[model samples]
Target: MGNKNTIIWIIVVVIIIILGVVVVGNRKAQAPANVQNQTQEESTAEEESLPNNEVLPIGNNQSEGSANTDTQVSSTAIVTYTDEGFSPSTLEIKLGDSVMFVNESSGGMWVASGPHPTHTLLPSFDQKKTVQTGGTYTYTFTQAGEWPFHNHVKSSEFGKVIVK
Candidate 1:
């Protein structure tokens, strides 16, 4: 009878330990769910506080007076170089626009410039396209600012893109 009682007590202790482990695990799992719920509630509250009628302007050549007009203009421009550098060293485009560079030189030599070296376009902009003689390269601008770029091959030959 004594041995039987000891075994029963041991079984009960084991069961209690298993139950405690399960409870702790359940609480740990529920903690992430609680955090997710709180995050979702905060996100919903933030969205509700934002203005509902806010709209972004689209198209090109947007001036103060032409803000309400629906006349859509092409925000893209083309810059071609045949002899030395870009035809228009100083270019003007909309805030969100793109420029295509066409290499018309005969030899395998082409480059462009901005506020800095054009080779830095890698890891920032699309520089995969190399302007090899007849090759063409295109770059798009999404941010608003004055960017000066220059060709790594020829630092003297540079250009500037004014984003308005």
Candidate 2:
């Protein structure tokens, strides 16, 4: 029992350290090359000029000269589905933005406002539509709240989108 407890403590500490390193590394990697060497005021100005509340694409996706990604940065926001579940299990978006549910797995998926079968959490948001692999479903979020959703096909996999 004591050995098991010691092992658990060691595992927890290692996980925390790894998470910290990943977070720090991501911050550095996400910053634009032009802004990395700039003064604080310059960085502040750059941020102020960007579109607010929408998640900014990292790296060259933000560059005016780069347009190689299959998905373009448009008014549409994406929530991708995988074999396990949603790629971004939690998302934040501006009110009135469209949320695109892309089914990337071999299995079809159902996205509905939840409490499982009832889906009464946001009744009007309910739908029987199922998107197959490589297919998509989009819903415009006009209401401001944290909307909980799940894959009806795989009920246990769920996520929420907070609209500001």
Candidate 3:
């Protein structure tokens, strides 16, 4: 009887240990998923509050275009997309300025370089070129016109870089 009781006690202890191991393993598996969710939420928040155009300082210890000998310095502008659609959908700049379209969306997007229904600006622009997440496309405008562009993948997302 003593031997039987000892065996039963050992079995119960083993069962408890197995249950503990299963619980710990399940928690370990869930930890990564929880961390991923938190990271995604933080990213979304940051995207919402991001500025429309991030102006980089031109040179060392000098304001933008201050040290340049030529007064006709090129300007850089960044266009970003958000939940409310393209931030600053209408961007005005000089004729010789350049604009950079940065795709921060999780999916693909494109910058159709021209007016809708008659896209004459970028005739060679591939309509199906997919700009995946965290991609950038630069376009220089040397002419004065209203160049309308939109995300071909998502038509509702539209913007224009007006070169004057």
Name the candidate that leads on lDDT. Answer: 2
Q: What tens digits encode model 3's per-residue C-alpha lDDT throughout 30-140?
A: 897788888888877666544322322323325534745233677878888654567679999886677887888877877776555355666533254767878777777
Candidate order by lDDT, highest to lowest? 2, 3, 1
Give the C-alpha miss distance for residue 41 in model 2, angstroms. Answer: 40
Q: Give the candidates in order of TM-score, highest first.
A: 2, 3, 1
lDDT of 2 by residue, 108-162 (tens): 8888899998899887665477878998878888889999999888888888989
> Is candidate 2 or 3 superior in TM-score?
2
Pick by lDDT: 1 or 3, better one: 3
Pairs of colliding residues, candidate 2: none
Q: Provide the global lDDT of candidate 3 against the true structure.
A: 0.73
Clashes, model 3: 0
In order, candidate lDDTs are: 0.65, 0.80, 0.73
